[model samples]
Target: MNDFKSLKPISVYSTKQAVDDGYLIQVDQKISQEAGIRYPVYLTRAVWDKYVEVPEGMEGHQDQSGRLWDVLFMFAFFGRKETSSHLLFKLRVHLPNTDNWEHNEKVAERSNRLLREVTLKALVTAQDFDDPSPAIFIMKPFED
Candidate 1:
């Protein structure tokens, strides 16, 4: 077995930086061409179990691709485990449609709650891997 203790902790690379590096255009383009509204979310396999879990309400109802994850699972899991693999998650998010202040406020409130409720570590992927390797964890906002 690989010595889990010896592998380097993953690194966190911002999505903006990835775009600036010109390494994410192909995936971004594919996202745009296939689904107009869905954005991308990613996480490595080493940390996947931490951030995702089946809630009681949606036990067996969720389809494989459409399953729901604990909102803070990623943050909580990665904060504890250390590994060298760079796993990527191609998930999507659907923000509220209406621009009403109250709705937006609620959204911001929830985001803050998650941030406050969970402590996120500065996690990132290793750089020596080949092109198109998975990142540690990142969620790109929906682009119209």
Candidate 2:
């Protein structure tokens, strides 16, 4: 059984800094304090830019052997909600534990597939995103 241990609520919003500086992933403040990690953690360039956005001049964008077509691909894949309840969970679980993200293409591909499957299932089971006791759990008290 593919038992997901817990879910992490993710809020992806646009900020001038994010657009200019690159993608940012900020774990909820309270959760970070509890987890003993930094708050408003900025995604490392190596981690965040593993995939680049497709330029306009480019004829088409394809998932290369060792590249992703930017994080927007992820948003599109996950149904583009303002609040994604288990995004961090899906990312942490699906992403392979490799120092080099590109080293294991097969593993990365598999992880992506699994994350999608689990996220979809959770969304379906939850039915309403605003339900107090949604099937997918939030990682922080602030989120409630």
Candidate 3:
């Protein structure tokens, strides 16, 4: 058998460090609890900037809390159907015209906004290398 115990990591990145470094944004515990998520939840900076944060022109149309709720709610709904450590779920977001055309072009003519469906990945794992408490980390599908 391989001697795994002899191997040593070059460096370690903890969840708490990630949050402090701005790489991970911790979701409000209360909001997550309201969505039926029992554990702590976090979002990658990319996910936060793209999906959760409302664009400058979309101030009246959407808010951060509502967008965050949509993400958590959808995850909770899909999470109940599967028994896996990782989950890929869909989120429909109303995006403002910010010159990012990679998303769906389906639009609501009245508002001139594009409704795009994005897939995000959620990972359930220990809070840190030494901490076994469960936590959920949300990020773009391609993110590590």
Candidate 4:
């Protein structure tokens, strides 16, 4: 008979483990590319869930790419847990590596409408997995 007391418990997740699991690699790569950075390069997600203070109405919607995450976009949020609710979308874009705020701002204006009030920032750091094996981080919306 299957005994509930003998059932194996599931393990929890850690950030560093996530780093090894290739969690945001695809999103990082694409974002880096759009931001004009090279791929396979390692950096950390800035204003991340662990660090950034999500506004009262904002939340994070992580992308779950499974084995095909390369085509997904990492979107952010700032609000309640309803599909139709009005909130905010967060997208942190990296500015040119060099000090070029003017061009960066201009780019934002042309590319993303969310840049107006949704809030945005550009920073360095998205940890690239050192391991060669491709892994995945199960992503989902940050629900309260």
Candidate 5:
């Protein structure tokens, strides 16, 4: 085998750096704990803005905390069925119907809000390659 130890990485991005740079938002400890997650959990910023952030004009109907809770709870619920470090789960959420379906009568019949299913990927791993502390990261299906 090639000498892997001789190779040096040109750049490195740790989980802590991602959190500090706002690329990853840490889920509240209390919420994760209540959701039966014993490890620290984080949601990629893209995931947060897309699903967890309540859209404009939806202030009273939904809040960030509740949205986040749904995500964590659903992950926990599905995670219990598997023992893998990586998990793929689907969460059903209500979001403003911004799709243009005027041509499709079937879709147009839906109300202003639509219940949508979104796929999220969760990885349970160490805080960093060198750190053994367990942690979790939830992100969109394609995100790293």
Candidate 6:
């Protein structure tokens, strides 16, 4: 049996293990390239900053081979209302090749940026809000 109140669970997350989720590559079409130098598709990105705080030691990172792209932080924000929910997410960035690395930083930056950006949907007006919408919100307060 489980407790109804006064219950909490442990949580752990890391940008270094991001590849394990497989969403990074699967979600972004721009990264669907075999050759690192090639990205036939265009990348997307968030229009504005989206995050509360990046925590203390959970910002950007660099790997042994120097291939890095920190999580920045994932934000679930709404463009229509305070209680809206969806795939819309934001992430900050700092790729090792962001400007003058072995790889084309533009490409890396573009693809990484794309992963945070959605497929680009039409915005909803205040009038378009559906009350009784249950007031949606997002926070990855759980683990797989």
Query: Model 1: residues >4 Å from true position, as ranges?
Result: 1-41, 45-47, 55-116, 122-128, 132-144
Error of 4 at 64 (Å): 15
User: Between prediction 1 and prediction 5, which has the larger lDDT?
Assistant: 5
* Model 1 lDDT per residue over 41-139, tens place: 343331222223333344465432332233333433443454543322222223223342221122324544222122223324432244354333433
Candidates' lDDT values, in order? Answer: 0.34, 0.32, 0.87, 0.33, 0.83, 0.26
Name the better of 1 and 3 by lDDT.
3
Better of 4 and 6 by lDDT: 4
Q: How do the residues 15-98 of candidate 4 rate in per-residue lDDT, one tens digit apiece? A: 466567744323456653553434333322432322232333334433322212221223222222324322323434332233
Candidate 2 wrong stretches, greater than 4 Å: 1-14, 21-44, 53-70, 80-86, 89-144
Model 2, range 14-48, lDDT digits (tens) per residue?
Answer: 33344366543332445433433222323334443
Off by over 4 Å in 6: 1-73, 76-82, 98-144
Residue 82 CA displacement from its true place in model 1, Å: 21
Model 5 local distance difference test score: 0.83
Q: What is the lDDT of residue 99 in candidate 3?
A: 76
RMSD of 2: 15.6
Maximum-TM-score candidate:
3
lDDT of 6 by residue, 1-144 (tens): 877666654653432233355322212323222223121211111211211223234355423111111221122122324343343433333422222222111232454632222222221222112333222122222211
Q: lDDT rank, highest first?
A: 3, 5, 1, 4, 2, 6
Least accurate stretch of 10 residues (summed lDDT) in model 4?
64-73
The parts of candidate 3 lying over 4 Å away from their true place are 1-3, 103-113
As a whole number from 0 to 100, the lDDT of residue 29 in candidate 6 is: 26
What order do you get sorting by TM-score, best first? Answer: 3, 5, 2, 1, 4, 6
